[model samples]
Target: METLEGAELCFPQLLNTSCRKPLQHHAETIFLYILLSCISLLTVVLNLLVIISISHFRQLHTSTNLLLLSLAVADFLVGLLLMPLQILLIGGCWFLESFMCGLFYYASFILTSASVGNMVLISVDRYVAICDPLCYPTKVTQKRVQISICLCWVCSVLYNGVILNAFLKHPDRYNTCYGECVVVIGFITGAVDVILTFIGPIAVIILLYMKVFVVAVSQARAMRSHIAAVTLQGSVSVTAKKSERKAARTLGVVVVMFLICFCPYFYPSLVGQDMSTSVAFSIFGVWLLYCNSCLNPVIYAFFYPWFRKSIKLIVTLQILQPDSCYAHIL
Candidate 1:
């Protein structure tokens, strides 16, 4: 009986202090690990493709694609780092040191926050492109977009640093036993994080996209009404309008998916409860949010012809040819 009990402890030698292993069946454990490992690998490969396509193809370099590139980088790290650690967590033990646990969560928060910022930036980009096409070129230049991306990342790092300061300083503060890692946020702090990281950004995204939708619909109606009277200049204007409307629709789907994946994760904070990683719902929420990173690249592949074209070039080794960067992707 003693030996059996010891076998169930995460650290058998430290029986009194160690956490008991979670009661999972052997086959169930193996299946979960395999499934999650495949997802992590898929997320990494897909996001890496997005990163390569945008960075290598000269024609793919636009203000909007730059924002996507930033998002892909964040998602890529999620798959490469966070997903693996999360897989370890499914075994119900923290094999690494306390400091590493803190670093893992800190990096997770930074990547998550940066993703929110990038979505907001994408919504704003589509808004301007659709609503005020005449001034979009001057207003949303590549230099300005680059500056905004930099600010987005810097602010995410600083904001999450402040939010997780206490946890970082003492990663084992809330642990119940050895082999466990957890973080608990006080109610006030959790509420503030929800507002800053979730609510405020979500509001901005929905509002901007709402305006984009209205304007796009109106423009479509006007173009259809006057289709017969289109001169060469009018035809060019109509074509540009069609392009903007299509972009708005595609990005609208992305924003909606972001909201769906993120809302449940923030529900506890929204309800004025303290956020704790030890809860079952929190674990489910975190995985759902991480799954969004994988989904984004799939969405791009479905909607963007340029991404498909670039994938073919990349897979066929055509990208290794001289001046392949100049290949027509758009």
Candidate 2:
């Protein structure tokens, strides 16, 4: 009986203090590792392409592209740091020191919250472009967008630091045994986080997008029914509205995808439970959230011609040529 019990222990030498290793078939373990590794690699590579594409090509340096760049940075970190660390923890043993554990959660919170903030910013950008086309240029300039992105990241770090303060101060305060790393927020704090990170942002995004859609439809109708005196001016007006509509459609797809990925992650909190990292469903939810990072670049590849063009230039090393930054991508 003692030997059998020891077999289940993650660290047999520790006897009474060691956490039990989770039971899983060897084949299942290997498959999870392979799948997660592929996801991590794909996410990193694709988001990296996005970063390079926007950073290298001056033509893509618009207000909207700056928001995409910020989102890509957050997604890139998920792939580079969070996903790999999560894969390690999937084995049900955390070998890292306590300080590393705190740092990991802190970074995860910052990135994830920052991604939400970027989405909100993207929604607002689309709203202004579609609903107030004439004012969009002055309202959403590159310098203003950069300042907003900086504030989004700063606010995310500070907000999450407060949410995770107790855990950060004593990383192992709730640990029952060695080989286990878990962070749990109190019910009240979890509820607040759900509201701040999930509910409030989602509400803002949906509301703004809805407004953009209504205004876009109205503009489309007006474009169809109106007759202008000058042919060239009418053509230019139609072209601008069409561009705005297309941008709205593409960004709508992104927001819908974001909702689908994030809802499952916040389900436990919605159901009135404290957020925990150890439960099986919690782990699955976390991975689902991470999977969104992998999907965003794919969405861009499908919808944006500029992304495809930039990717081609990058892969063929055309971006390395002199004055490639001025390459006409759009």
Candidate 3:
């Protein structure tokens, strides 16, 4: 009944409920609209470039790097497909007519499910490498890693499919506005998603990482044993041990990023989902999730010497070759 421009006008009142001081509705709407659009487009394009650079370069195609590439690709798709339309919605311009809405949201939801699942898998991979060093190679072979990646997609599809169908508009109830309500359907769907996406995966990741971190520490102590056992072999053993530590540290960053990027997406369910409240909370979630696209490259750049070397090598060769600008010189 009452139109309070958009998220801006409503946000302050939301924080200070008693104050009831509304924002300049139109100005806030316009600013939010522009902000979302710029962020969406910019992040989308950057992630695509990152994916291409990784794929096109031979030196950057290790198993771990491949997993990172998949993450960037998935997040890039979320930014490109979902965020731009969400920006339009924030501007009160919902261009996805009734037909396309379900399909678009379905793709976005499924891919996001896959993305979180993959994060869990990546943690497991790193955990195995750090904790069970002897078995890591035999257990996580190239074939095994590929199979795990495929299983991630499979799990995402089945999990989201059941949940989506549970909320699907029944043909029998389609005509009755009084009996068939979308909000009730939305509440059920959101609750299920919150459990599968956040609760389940969060539990698994924490348990696995705890094991991994503890093992990493123990192994670090074990390095001292190498000094007396084989003084000449100490250098090789230490190098291997350092690599193991670095992988664990990278996984720590991955866990923190996943938690920060995705927690907002689940907050609406944790709080009571009054329509207006849910609207702002959901938008914040989407924006935070979109922000994750820019972080992987940055984290890798700062923390991963191997990844930095690969990126630098790729860039250097581009300047060296005219026709084959993408090829590495070495």
Candidate 4:
């Protein structure tokens, strides 16, 4: 009886303090491991390809792609660092030290906030390109976009630091047993975080996309009406408008998907409950949110011809050739 009980504890030596292992079927555990492993691997590969594509091809280094590169970097870190840790967590044990637990949650919050920031930036970029096309080149310069990306990351780090200050100072504060890792935010902080990180950004993205949609429709109709009267210069203008509209549509899909993935994660806050990582619903929400990182690159491959072309070059190892950065991707 003693040996059997000992085997069930996370730390057999510290039986009184250690958490008991979760009761999971052996086959079920194997299945979950395989399924999650595949998702993690896929997320890593897809985001890595996006990073390589945008970074390697000079033609792909426009201001818009820069936002995508920032997003991919966040998602890549999610797969490389967070997902594996989450996978290990499936057995309901925290093998690492308390300090490492604090760092893990810190990194998670930073990446999540950064992703939200990037999405908001992408929406604004599309709004400028589609609604104010003539002024977009001057208004949204590469230097400006670079500065925006840096601020997004820096702000994410600082913002999450403030929110998680207490948790960071004492990572083991809420742990009920020796092997558990969890964070529990106060209701007020969670409410503020939801509004700042989820609600406010989502509202902005939707409003911007709504205006973009309206403008795109009007532009499409005008282009069709003027199709017969198009001279060489007029045709060029129409082509540019079409390109901008297509980009808006593609990014609109991305924003919609982002909302779908993120909505559940913030539901507890929406309902005026404290955000606690120990809750089953919160665990599910976190994984769903993480899955969004996997989906973003897939969306790019589906909608953007340049991404597909870049993937082909990368897979064929043609990117290894000299001066490959100058290859025409667009």
Candidate 5:
């Protein structure tokens, strides 16, 4: 096989057809990619189910779930439309004309950017709801939440759109099977992408979550201070406290997942040094980073009993009943 750049891009392709074991591993990796795409799709579907179930129920509909609905929709789009192409990309198949290729890649980047941005918004929204319960409803109205979600998508699209334009200006950018892209410009553009995608959002998440943590602790203390008031209040205040604790636990899991899945892609970008890792490592790094999208349904399964219950309920109702009986249930 021939080479293109310095040693950076060579590392991944080196193991492709040039090596005996590596050539044998290609089939297996493709199979695993199928599995990966399936798992990612499953999570996306599950998240969508949660959104649909919540929306249909109406009792479960809230501003928070609306944000979650947006997130679920974005993630589902990635899993359905993006992940398979990414698997193809990893296997060194360009599979499109230049403009189409640019469009596909940019859409993936923009959707991902929007998802992380939505997460930061969710964290801040939760912090406000918890820290200042009295002001929560007025501050985070339904209209504001909708506007915020739209803005997140717009910002994400605009940011990645610039990078797409920058990278798509190749001279031999022709309709050919040989997939060649200007990845050097991508390096600088991608650094900006990483910051918008990870750093700025993560900093906001951590800062907002810090306030969330402190507010939670403060609320706990205040509850203690108001034991007398609570005693006079009966079971209402206790129920409210329990719900607050539940929301905090859910938020905590989200923050931890963000840190673990996203940190690998962040620091290298921030340092302004090109990746010195092998291409295999770089490829694996990207897949691992996207694995965060696959993790949400699993985390929801483990952390949120309501989500699980809803899933179970929907499955049992939908599959357990026949099409003849479905109308009656509906």
Candidate 6:
């Protein structure tokens, strides 16, 4: 009986200071490992494609795709870094040092916050383009959008540093055993995190999209009425504008999916509790959140013809040819 119990401990040699392994069936564990491994791989591949498509294609170097590029970067890191670490945690125990544990959560919060920030920027960009098309060219220039993205990422790093300050200062303060890795925020700090990261950003996203939808419907009606009266050049411009709106609508779906995946993870904080990754439900919530990174490219950007073309070029190694970047994708 003692030997069996020792076998279940994460570090059998450190009996008293090791966490017990989670009681999971062998088949179930194998299934979960395979499933999450696929998610992580898909997330990495899809986001990498988005990154390559936007970075290599000159036509896609617009203010909007810049935001998407930032988002894909974040999602790419999720698959490359966070998802693997999480899979390790979910397996049984955190074999890494406590300091690494704190660093992991710190990086996770920064990426998650950056993703949210990018969504808000995307929403604002769409809102301006749809509701105030004339001013969009002046207001949402590439330089301005690039600056906004830089600030978003900088702010995310700084904000998470503040939120995770305690953990940074004392990495193992929350650990109960050598094999355990955990992060705990106080109720007040967790509430603050929820308000800033979840509530406020979500409010801005929903409101902007709401206004964009109303204005988009009205514009569609106006365009339809004016279609016959417009000249050829004017008609071309209108078509281009319509295409912009279509892209916005696609990204809006991405934002909604992000909210759907994240809300459940933050619900415990809404109910006045710190997020605990040790529990089964919390781990499930975290994985669900990470899965969003995998879906964004497929659901939001992969449908574009230009994206398909870019992928073909990339796969065939044609992108390395002379002036490939100058090749018209759109």
In the range 1-330, model 4's lDDT, one tens digit per residue, is 445464688888886789878778999889978988898899999999999999999999899999999999999999999999888778888999999899999999999999999999999999999887767888999999999999999999999999999999999999999989988888989989999999899999999999999989988887678643556533437678888888888888888888999899888899998887753653489889989999999999999999999999999999999999999999
Q: Mind giving the per-residue lDDT tens digits that candidate 6 earns over 1-330?
A: 445454688888987778888778999888988999999999999899999999998988999999999999999999999999998987669898888888999999999999999999999999988877667888999999999999999999999999999899888888887787888888988999999999999999999999988877877887888753455533436777788779878988898899999988898899998777675864668988999999898885555788888888998999999999998898
Note the Cα lDDT for every prediction shown. Answer: 0.90, 0.89, 0.65, 0.90, 0.66, 0.88
The lowest-lDDT stretch of 10 consecutive residues in candidate 1 is 227-236
Where model 3 places Cα greater than 4 Å from the true spot, the runs are 1-24, 166-191, 224-236, 271-278, 309-330
Q: Write the residue-wise lDDT of candidate 5 on 149-230 in tens digits.
A: 9988888887766766655565224322245321333467657767767877888888888888887776678677875253
Could you give me the TM-score of model 4 versus the true structure? 0.95
Model 3: what TM-score?
0.76
Error in Å for residue 153 of model 1: 0.4
Per-residue C-alpha lDDT of model 1 across residues 102-152, encoded as one tens digit per residue: 999999999999999999999999999987777888899999999999999
Question: What are the per-residue Cα lDDT tens digits for candidate 3 across 74-153?
Answer: 87887888777666545432334333445555676787887888788888888777776667767878677777778888
Candidate 5 Cα errors over 4 Å, as ranges = 1-27, 169-177, 180-191, 221-236, 274-282, 318-330
Per-candidate TM vs. native? Answer: 0.95, 0.95, 0.76, 0.95, 0.78, 0.94
Could you tell me how far off, in angstroms, the CA of residue 321 lies in candidate 4 after the best superposition? 0.7
**Winner of 5 and 6 under lDDT:** 6
Q: What does the lDDT read for residue 59 in candidate 2?
A: 97
lDDT measured at residue 38 in model 6 versus the true structure, 0 to 100: 92
lDDT (10s digit) by residue, model 2, range 53-80: 9999999999999999999999999999
State in Å the error of residue 265, model 1: 1.0
